[model samples]
Target chain A: MKTVKNESSKGSPRPAHVLQKSRLWLMYPPRLITTPVVWQLGQKHKVITNVRQASVTDEIGIVCLELEGRRADIKAAIRWMTNLGISVEPVEINIIES
Target chain B: MDKNTGFMKALKCRECGREYPLEATHVCEFDFGPLEVVYDYDRIKHSLTRAVIKSRPQSMWRYRELLPVAGEPTVGCQVGYTPLVKADRLAKRLGIRELWVKNDTVNYPTLSFKDRVVSVALSRARELGFSTVACASTGNLANSVAANAAAAGLKAYVFIPSDLEQGKVVNSLVYGAHVIGIRGHYDEVNRLCAEIAGKYGWAFVNVNMRPYYAEGSKSMGFEILEQLGWTVPQHTVVCMASGSLLTKIHKSYQEFMKLGIVAESRYKVHGAQATGCSPISTAQKAGLDFFKPVKPNTIAKSLAIGTPADGFYALKVMKETGGAAEDVTDDEVREGIKLLAETEGIFAETAGGVTVGVAKKLIASGHIPQDASAVLCITGNGLKTLDAIAGHVGQTREIKPSLREFEALLDKENKLINA
Candidate 1:
C-alpha cells in the first residue's frame, strides 16, 4: 500500500493542506465485535492504523486506534464505523493514557 | 538505576504499538496516543514483597515498586498514609453493614487527594532535569501543586479557572507560586494550558508529566487494601474529575492481585459525580460506552470536569465489575455534606458531598447491596468550599456574653429542639 502522506493530486486541490493525524478511542458493540472494521479501514482507505490498547469482551470491544491519513478519508472511515453502531471519540489518548 | 527504583521497562503507547524512553514525555509523538508507565512486573513481584513494603515509611512511597520514579521521592514526604476511618455512625445512617471513609480531606499539606499525584509528578519532574513545574487545575489540584512545588523549592506556575472558590485561590497564592487565573471554565483553561505546555518546557503535572502524575492515585487504593488488613473492600466509591483516580484505584487493585499480595477476590468499583457535570455517570446510566462532553454546572467545582478524559475506561470498570455510577444534584450535595458532618463529624468538600450523596442514592436504590461493606472516598476539606453550604447549614446563634444569657439560650434551644 502506498503511503497516504504524499497522495495529493496536483492542480486539482489538496484536500488536506497538511498531514492529518488523529487518535481515537472507539467502542464496538457486541454485534460488531466479530467484524474486521479496523483491518478493513486500513485496506480500503488511505490511512495507517495503529492500535494502542484494547479490551474485548463478549459484550463490547473497546479499542484505542491512531489513524494517520488524509482528513477526508479519516472522516469517512469514522462515519462508516459509526453507521455500524460503533462509537468513536476524538480523545487525547496519549498524554495520560493510563 | 538505584536498587530503590523499580524495574521500569519503558513508556508504551496504549493506541499504537510503540515504545519510547522512560522520560518526561507522556503522549505518543507518532500517533498522539497516551504513554503508559510499563514495568518489569516479574522483577517487581520478586522485590516488592509485603514485608519490604511494610518496612518502608508509612507514606505512598511504600509502594515504590509500582510507582514510576527512578529514585526516592524527595517531595511531599509526608503525603499519603491517610486515615481510613471505619465509619460506624455513617454506616448506621446509610443502613449499610459496614462503611469506611478513605479520608484524604486530611491529606498532608494541601488537604486533598491531589497531594498523592503531585508528589510523584514533581519528583519525576525534578529527576528529569526540569526546574519548573505547572498544572491546569479546578481548585484542589492547584492548591496541591502550589504547596508541593513550594516545598520542593521548584519554580511553580498554577493555572486555574477564575471562578474557583476564594479559599483555593488564596491557598495557591500563599504558597508563593505564580497563579494564573484564566477567565474561562476548566475545559478552556486546560486547552490553553496544553498550548502553553507546548511552548514552554515546564513540566505540567497533568500534561507532559501525566503518566507519572496519574500513577500517584494508585497509592490511595493501595492504602485502602492495606488498611483493611490487606484485603480489598467489597465496594469503593470514588469522586470523578478527569476520571483518572477511579481508573487508577481499579488498576491498583488489579496490580495487587497480579503481584500475589492479595488473594483473588471480587470487588466492585463505583464512581461518584455531581449532576452538573457527570458525563461518565450519565453515559454509564445510558448503557453507552462513550460519553458526550457537557458544560459543567454544579457546586462540586473540584469535580467539574465536563469532558472526563478517562470516562471510557471508568465505564469499562463499572461494567466489568457489575458496579454502578451515579450523580447527585446540588441540593443533595449540600445535604450530603450536612449528613456526613452531623453523623460522622467528617466535614468534606463538595466533591466529598457528591460521593456521599451518590452512595446514599445507590444504597437506597438497592444498587449497593444492603449488607455489602463499602468505602466512600472523601477527597477534599470542606473549608475550601464553605460557600457551597454557607446559608444551607444555618448560621450560628447569637448569645449575650453572660452565663445567665447562655443558660437562657440553652433552655430556648432545648425547647426548640424538643418542638
Candidate 2:
C-alpha cells in the first residue's frame, strides 16, 4: 500500500521537513534536449530529481520526473524549469473513466 | 475469492508488461505506467460468438465475457445497447455522405455513457470485497457512481468540481450519496482524489478500479459495431475528456476484428475537444507525440479535463489510424447542440456538442472525406447541462390561452413570411 505521501519509499530517508513528493511530466523543446536541465535543477534547488521514464527523439524529449523535497522547494524548482522554457505539468494517471 | 476470473488473465502494465493480480489497483509500482487488463482472447473467441451474443439479453452484460466481471453483473445490468441513429439530415447539413450517432444520451439509469463504466467498476468492486466506492468526476461520472452505488447498496463518496452544472449535482445528491464538492477545477479535484484513494481503501472507480471501469467503455463500441450490422464505421468521432472513450472505442473495433466477428476493415478513430481544453487535439495538430496540459475554461464541463490520462494513447490511435482531431469554441458547441436537436431530434450535452462540432470541422477540412461515412458518439444527454445553452437556445414567445391571440400571432407570422 504505497501512498504518494511516502517519500522514503525509493531513496534514503529524508528529514521531516523534506516531506512533499511530486510526479511531474517535463517536456523539453528541441533546443533544450541537449541541456542538463534535470541536473541543473538538482544543483540549484534543495530537491531530489529522479527520472522515472524518459523518451527522447531528435524533435522533442519527455521525461516522467519525480521530485522529492520541501513543497516550496519543489514548487520553486518547477518555476525555475518553467522559466527556462520547459513545459512542467503534473503527471497524468488514471483520473478519468469516460 | 472467485476461483474463476472470467476471460481476464491479469492486470498488465502498459509500459513494462509486468502482470499483477486482478485487484483494485491501477498503476504500476515500478515504472508508474497505467495498468490495463489483458484477456484470454482464444477462449473468448470460441465462446463469444455472434450467436451467443445475439441470444443474450439486450444489455452491456451480453458482452460479459469480454467485460472484466468474474460473475454475473449485480450493478447496471441494463446499462448499454443505446441507439445507433442514422442522421441523414445532419449528414446533409454537414456535407457528409452518411452520419450515425451512437446515442448514449438515453443510456439506462444515468442518461450518460458513465453508466457503462460505473456498472463494470461497482460490479468488480463487489467481487473484490469492497463495500465502498468513489470517483473524482466533472459531472457524468459522479451521477453514475452515486446512482449505481445506491442501487448496489454500497457506500459511495463522489468528488467533483464545485462549479458543475446544477442538474448534474442534483442528480447525484438525490441518490443520497456523499457528494463532496471541491472548490477547484477538475484537475485539482482529481489530484486530491488521488491522495484520498492512496490513503483510503475505498475503490475509486477511475483510480484504483480503473482498468475494469475503463474496459466497460468497450461495450459502447461493441454496440456500435453490432448495430451497424457488424461493420466498423469508416470514421468514429469521439469526444475527449481524459480521451479514454476514444481509445477504448478503437480497442473495441480491434477486439471484434480479432475475434473474427467483424471483417477486417480500415477505420479512423477521430477525437474531439472544446477549444478551451484542447490538449490532445492541440498536440495532434502540432504533430507532437506529447501534449502540454492546459487550464480548462470550456462550457463543456464534462470534457474539461486539463490533463487527460489516455491522451498519449489517443494520439497514438489517431496517428496509427490516419484519423484527425479538432476542437470547437463554446458558441460552436451551442450551435452543435441546436443543430443535432433540430436535425435529428436528439438533444446532447456539451460533450456531444463537441463531437458534432468537431465532426463538422473534420468534414469541412477534408480530414474526413465528404463521401466517407462516420459515427459521432453522443455520450451524454443535454438535459443534464441546460445551463450551457440556457440563454443561447432562444426565448419562448409568451401568449395567453386564447384562440384570438393565437390567430393574431399566426397572422402576423404569415404576413412577415409573405413580406
- Kindly give the number of clashing pairs for every candidate: 8, 0
Name the top TM-score candidate: 2
Stretches > 4 Å off in candidate 2: A1-23, A27-37, A40-48, A56-61, A67-91, A94-98, B184-188
Q: What are the per-residue Cα lDDT tens digits for candidate 1 across A48-90?
A: 8889768787767878788777667877887777677776655
Please give, for residues B1-419, the per-residue lDDT of candidate 2 as tens digits: 23468889999999999999998888777777889999989989888999999999999998898899988899998889999999999999999999999999899998999999899999999999999899877678888999999999999998877776676678889999998888864444555666666657788898888899999999999999999999999999999988889999999999999999999999999999999999999999999888876778999988877768889999999999999999999999999999999999999999999999999999999999999999999999998888899999889877999999999999998999999
lDDT of 1: 0.83
Off by more than 4 A, model 1:
A1-98, B1-5, B163-165, B184-188
Q: For residues B1-419, could you state the per-residue lDDT of candidate 1 as single tens digits?
A: 45434467888986685988887777787656678888888888888888998999999989988988987888998899999999999899998999999999899998889899999999989888888998876577888899999999999998867776676778889999998878863433544565466557788898878889889999999999999988999999998987889999999999999999988899899999999999899989989887766668999878876667778788999999888999999999999999889988999999999999999999999888988999998998998898889999887888778999999999999999999
lDDT scores of the candidates, listed in order: 0.83, 0.87
Best by DockQ: 2
- C-alpha TM-scores of all predictions: 0.82, 0.89
lDDT of 2 by residue, A1-98 (tens): 22354423433444556467777777887899999999999999999888989989887788888888886798689779878988765654536333
